[model samples]
Target: MAEQTLKEKTAKGLFWGSINGGIQQILNVVFGIFLARLLSPGDYGLIGMLGIFMGVATVLQDSGFSTALINRKGIKHEDYNSVFWFSFSVGLICYVILFFCAPLIADFFGHPELTNLSRVLFLWFLIGSTSIAHSAMMTKKLMVKERTKIEVSAMIASGIVGVVLAYKGYAYWGIAIQTVTNAFVGAVLRWYYVKWRPTFTFALRPLKEMCSFGVKILFTSIFAQINANIFAVLLGRFYKEDQVGYYTQGNKWMNMGYTFIWGMIGNVSLPVLSEVALDVKRQRQVFRKMLRFVSFISFPAMFGLALVAPELIVIGVSDKWLPCVPVMQLLCIWGAVTPINNLYIHVLLSQGKSNIYLYNTIALGVVQLLVVVSMLSLGIYYMVLAFVVVNVLWIFIWHYFVNKYVEISILDVAKDILSFCLISLIVLCITYFVTKLIFNIYMLFIAKVLLATFLYTFVMYLSGSVTFKESFTFLLKRK
Candidate 1:
């Protein structure tokens, strides 16, 4: 009965998580199209230059307490209260420091205009901090439905703000304000939906108790953020803003593609896996199931995006953004495997292996930084190629540590995802060839999308893919 209850919760979480990710991405693409059409790559590159700073600040503000809170058994109001105050305090500190250091950041990137941009952008750190505990509470309770409402409402409100600003010729400021607005609105809605309030009885004891676990997560997240944005930092330092913009634009689409898959897995993976942490066999079973599900969605989605990159970019944003096409295609390769890596990390975190998580992530980050730096003189494409290759290969390293806790070998891992990966590759290749002769970009884009979807579905059905069938049936039942 307990297992059945967990299964139900997991299913519901996935359902709402899907809704959240799907709607969020749709809004992202819609608003993104308008902004991309209105703004230049240099505009986006300027904002992208600060990606590392914002990413690191946000990680430091949250301090991983949200994950720690969720993983802790029998969590209390005091735990949530402690995290809330701590997060807000850290956020304020981060914002103030960044505000003062904005000039230094601008100087580092050789962009004098970044001083004001960084200051305004840093506000999101403070605004987003106020909601960490509330957001964590929703995740802990598997209130994905409520969380979905908050996120979608926030996106819609912010999207409008961003589009209007861009349409009025605000340039990069539009993107910056859009980001800050999303955080502000989401924070407000989180508090509204999550009735849990932090008490005045903030205590050091609870913070200290969760610190060991949370700190490791904090460092891990910090390293991961750095790795993710290192490219932007390097490109900004060594190349033109427009070059950085191209990479940024491409990466944005790639991120959206995989985020749709990982977002759903993320909402349920940790909490659900934490539930079965003590049962190694059961944990492995659950982990493998999620692995299959992510693979089923991630491969075709990302690869298909790669297949239609030329047409999609041209049709969606126009020829001015065409430079990002190859970049987007390369990044899609890494995007496809990212969710599987995330699942492996969750398994380690679920079993209280924060140390392992920290060390592994730090190692990956260091190697990625070194690889990108080594390929620096070669150009952005080489840098991106190296980045993608290293990340995709790092799965084995993750699997190595995950095996310690879950007893699932690399072969077991491959068995779950490899076929899906190969099938997606073959199907997309065929779709590309079939659609290659179409001269009209619009027609080619539509043809590639439709044909790929049909072929992938037909193959999944023919091959008796349980993940495919289960997902289809689940959506049908929900509808």
Candidate 2:
């Protein structure tokens, strides 16, 4: 196979990434509707409470080797082999420990059933451990099409298992099994796609070399997970399962919207940026273009999701889930800004500034944890609101580091992204008012979505958005 030029690689990557994210979100929405209807709030809450532990364990299992492998200038079978063995070993150890610790976790939550649930749910980490090297290899080679197939198929298979089990009254157990199945399927498919096979060559030298870069990433990933899942932990501890469930439902929906946009950007940005790490001019150009694309989709999709949350929730999962609507609305704002921070960190990583990524994530995570903890007495709503505010303010913080590293100033970023943000907000507000007179929730939701989409697209077209025009042209050309 001839080596693909950077332009060709990037275009192909973005194309597959868009398809992957779009299809994944659609599948998730369909499966989610059925599962949410079949299960109770307490069921989702049970699984949600263990999110932090599961997240941290996942980070530890991979131990940042995947990013380390990607950032490495040269590749060898030994490098991949060492990572595979190391991760598998680490995952096995973590699972054994967590398996025994499940009792303590259950005791803390006052839910005896969690002892078994935790043991079963933690299998995802073990399953995922096997795929780290394969995934890294695929990502480094820009094999987005294969990866997209693995992920989408895994989601579909797992969704079927979840819906069936939930319908059979398995509750949280169904959710756990579904997750495990997805990881298992992805791992299997990754191994099949990437022909690299590990030998009996267990070498410490490759492991040590990668650990220098990987360790910082490991801790950074851990802190990031902790920051993200701290709410589930806090809510589980201080509030009822139902309360945690409400927040879980909302966060799930909000994540779907932003992840769609981020998914497309994230799949291509890191590897592409890494390829141009040495050229400041090229990096800046590439980064800004990505920034604009992400902002253009992010602001409208998330803000519009917030607008339609009430209707969407009621129509999809029934009125019982209405309490989650406000929480979902607030989280949609956080979701909107996540990609900006994510892109900045990816840029830093490509520049081999893992220390910067580690420090910034730790500082922010600690602060957010303290703030959320302090507000526990107030309410979950206040805590979530504080989370959103901190996240929005942190964009400047992210931009500061990005500017220092790449000479892309805050003003440059704002100029590129702010127009989309303001326009999307205006369009959503108008759509909301226009649809407020509608009596049916389904009609109101559909109207708001259509109106917002048309208005945003028309405005971008009128305002001469190169990103919008280029994206349209790119898809048309691909078709």
TM-score of every candidate = 0.99, 0.98
Stretches of candidate 2 exceeding 4 Å from the true structure: 1-4
Cα lDDT tens digits, model 1, 273-312, are 9999999999999999999999999999999999899888
Candidate 2 C-alpha lDDT tens digits along 1-479: 22247877887888898888899999989999999999999999999999999999999988898998888987898999999999899999999999999999999999999999999999999999988889989989989899899999999999999999999988898899999999999999999999999987799998798777889999999999998888888889888999999999999999888878887868689988998889998899989988998898899989989998988998899989999999999999999999988999999999998888899999898888888888999998999999898888988888888888799877889898999999998998899788889998778878998999999999999999999998999999998
lDDT score, candidate 2, position 264: 82
Candidates in order have lDDT scores of: 0.92, 0.90
RMSD of each: 0.9, 1.5
List runs of model 1 lying over 4 Å from the truth. Answer: none
**Best-matching candidate per lDDT:** 1
